[model samples]
Target: MRLALVLAGRYPDLRGSQVLVQQLADGIRGRGHAVHLVTYGAVASGRPGPRAGRIVRDLGLVVRLWRTVRREAIDLIHAHNYEAAIASLVVGRATGRPVVYHGHNALAEELPLYFRARRARGLAHRLGRLLDAHVPRRADFCIAVTEELGEILRRRGVAARDLTCIAPAAAPCDAAAHGPRVGSEALVCYAGNLDGYQNLGFLLRSFARVRARVPAARLVLVTHAAPGALRRAVGPGVEIVRAASYDEVRARLDAADVAVSPRAERYGFPMKLLNYMAAGKAIVASAGSAKGLRDGVTGRIVPDGDEVAFAAAVVELLSDAAARARLGTAARHAVEDPRAWDGVLDRIERVYRNVLAARSAASTDPEASAPDGLGVAAE
Candidate 1:
């Protein structure tokens, strides 16, 4: 089937939503379906054509969507994030096509909105929940990344039966990425944006303790701002690296002895664990991180903020080659063998099919449902 996936941003971007858009496109296409991506790009620059190309890409992205939706003859519109979901809502209304909203994270619930008062936090939550409920109603089905998130959608009034799971897709890289044999310097890798709700500072303290025992341990920070904004943690062995491509990241995973995740449980799903698992690396993540992992089979999950336990897990994995190898093997196999990947994609497709079916059913019912004004005007 031909699928038009909507992204919350433009092409040549590095945000989480963009990455998911690229991955979903790759995965669905791998399954023999045609997929096209729509995202924003720079437009209306003060500089001339070539130079101005970098200004306000989001505006150009809307134009791209307008043209592509018509040119590609897309079968299903799949919206990846909030803005793109709004775009899909617009396209679906304009063209009478079925739109599938793939909910990646629960930001409206996890964080505040519109800068409301402290007393309004409860009220803000109610509104966020309401928005979440209304946002995906336009779609035939809502695809959530985790069961926890799926439940959030349901709590906001999404039909439980209407939600599907498409585990985030991660591509594995070559062993050469293992990087120069890793040596006695046990390297720990953390990759993601340092901004927003991610509690990296907590993880740094945890890592310091780990370093005390494992003196040769090194920490590699690959974040959008870490290389510049984040000061080096007070440690001798820690090393901060800038963000790398999929290939370079895989190489780091291939080389590193262990991977760590210290996300606050209340924040959101740590999609990075899936990436580490896909690369066949042993992980030392919080229980929140392990939520998506299979535990003893895939990797160890410690309680959130338990630096001693978190550090111990890292050291244990670092010290035991056989256990690390075993866990790493399990994590890799977890992606493909007897796991729910195929089911995940099937759920995604099911959402599209059901939405189309219901929308078709609706066309005969006389109320061609109007578009919900969820998509925010591009900034």
Candidate 2:
């Protein structure tokens, strides 16, 4: 099958979206499918100027898809997010092709001010609703990342039959030891975007409290958010670093005795939870972060927003080496029971095969002419 992997960012950045896209595209192409990428470099951070702001982002991708689809013989377009979904919807409509929309979040609900669904007003503090309103029910298939998010789509009138819940996969952490040795003080890491919604302040406050009990404790903040603000607010007993190189990230993860994922979002599973688990590090995470773990069996879970519970959980885990090691062992092996990347793409390939076979068998003619600038076959 010929597949076009689409995203709204740069190709090889040190970000999750870019990393996931590059790996997914390579996997699909390696598995005997012709894979091509259609992206808007403007939105990607370090590529060039003029990032794809609200309205023009998806439209830009649509323009790129229009120029590449037929020329590359793209049989399926797997768009990564809403902006990319709009691109797939437009180009597929003009070319009479099918598209699989990867639902990274419940757009109208999670980023409400940003989506067009009229009921989405005040849902989020962003602006993207106008386009969401113009292009509703645009994809042939919608892939939801979590069950909570899937229900949001159904509530909004999306057909349950057209939906598939494919939880995002995390690469194993066995290979996370190729960087500099971590610090000596009991190292704890919280790595992610520096956005305000991340609630780093809460984590920092808890870390300060944890320091009173464990004086040698080191709280590592790996992010691109306001390091200056973080440095000012961190007080003592904290190490604020902007961002680490890819290898450095893994090294830091491996070096840390405990990793924390403090997520405040109600929707979208914490993908970082998987990374911490993969690294085999003891986790003293938010009650929300604990949702990804199996309680004491995997890692410790603390109540959300409760500094006492959060700090105590970290301190208790740090004091008990045997228990922490037990939990870490289980955490590291949690995902091994499931498929890794190669296994994940194998399942995806099956989905693509079935979609193609059904589309082909249903078509009456295989030799139908495609669009003037494109090609199409009626199935």
TM-scores of the candidates are 0.80, 0.81
Q: CA shift at 201, candidate 2, in angstroms?
A: 2.7
How would you encode candidate 2's per-residue C-alpha lDDT over 234-287 as one tens digit per residue? Answer: 767687775546666676677887888766554466666766777777887776
Candidate 2 yields a Cα-based lDDT of: 0.67
TM-score of 2: 0.81
Residue 307 CA displacement from its true place in model 1, Å: 2.3
| Span of 10 residues, lowest total lDDT, candidate 2 | 370-379
Q: What is the lDDT of every predicted structure here?
A: 0.66, 0.67
RMSD per model, one decimal: 6.8, 6.2
After superposition, the stretches of candidate 1 with alpha carbons farther than 4 Å from their true spots are 13-16, 30-32, 41-60, 112-130, 169-181, 224-226, 232-234, 266-269, 336-340, 365-379
RMSD of 2: 6.2
- Highest-scoring model, lDDT: 2
